[model samples]
Target: MGTLYYGDAASPIEIEDRALAHVKVVIATKLRRGESFTLSWAHGEGQEPGRSTVWLHPSIPLRFAFTEAEPALLSRAWIEELATSANSSGGLMIVPEPERGGETGPR
Candidate 1:
């Protein structure tokens, strides 16, 4: 599991390491360009069933912590999908990566 620490929130958002890695890339790109957006996601199993949204801004403190010692291989299609969401009016919805065959791109 990975933990995303946003600002000074007492509870860190926990996510799977692979998904969180991809999310980190997309977030960094948007924040670097001074773009602001909301990130929405459905809560994972074992907790209260609900959805959550967080407003992401360039000035806010955000950190991604992974449990793995080495970085996981990223999927290009997934990254593009996330980037598209980041540009949308509804903001970035953290959906699972779409399935594709033999296709990979740079991280």
Candidate 2:
């Protein structure tokens, strides 16, 4: 698992390491362009069954920590899909990546 620490929040948002790796790329591109938007995710059914949205701004501090020692491979198709969502009026919506064997793209 990986954790994304945003702003001054003490508790970090937990996500699968591979998923977080891909999300980081999309977020970095947006921030690099001085763009700000919301990133929303639904709480897992095992825990709170609600959704939460976070405002992603250049001013806020963001950190990504991965549990696995090695970095997972990344996919360009997934990044592009995420970029499309980020560019939409509704902002970025976090979704799970496709299955490992079924996924294909750049490293």
lDDT of each candidate versus the true structure: 0.88, 0.82
lDDT of 1 by residue, 3-83 (tens): 999999988999999889888999999999999999988899997999999999999999999999788778888888999
How big is the positional error of residue 22 in model 2, measured in Å on the Cα after superposition? 0.5
Per-model TM against the reference:
0.92, 0.86
lDDT of 2: 0.82
Compare the candidates by TM-score and give the number of the best one: 1
| Tens-digit lDDT string for candidate 2 (1-107) | 78899999866888788888888888999999999999887775566788888999999999989998887778766777788998998788888765455454434
| Candidate 2 local Cα displacement, residue 30, angstroms | 0.5
Q: Which 10 residues in a row give candidate 2 its minimum summed lDDT?
A: 98-107
Q: What local lDDT score does residue 101 receive in model 2, on the 0 to 100 scale?
A: 50
Candidate 1 Cα outliers beyond 4 Å, as residue runs = 100-107
The deviation in Å at residue 77 for candidate 1 is: 0.2
| Candidate 2 residue 6 C-alpha distance from true site, Å | 0.4
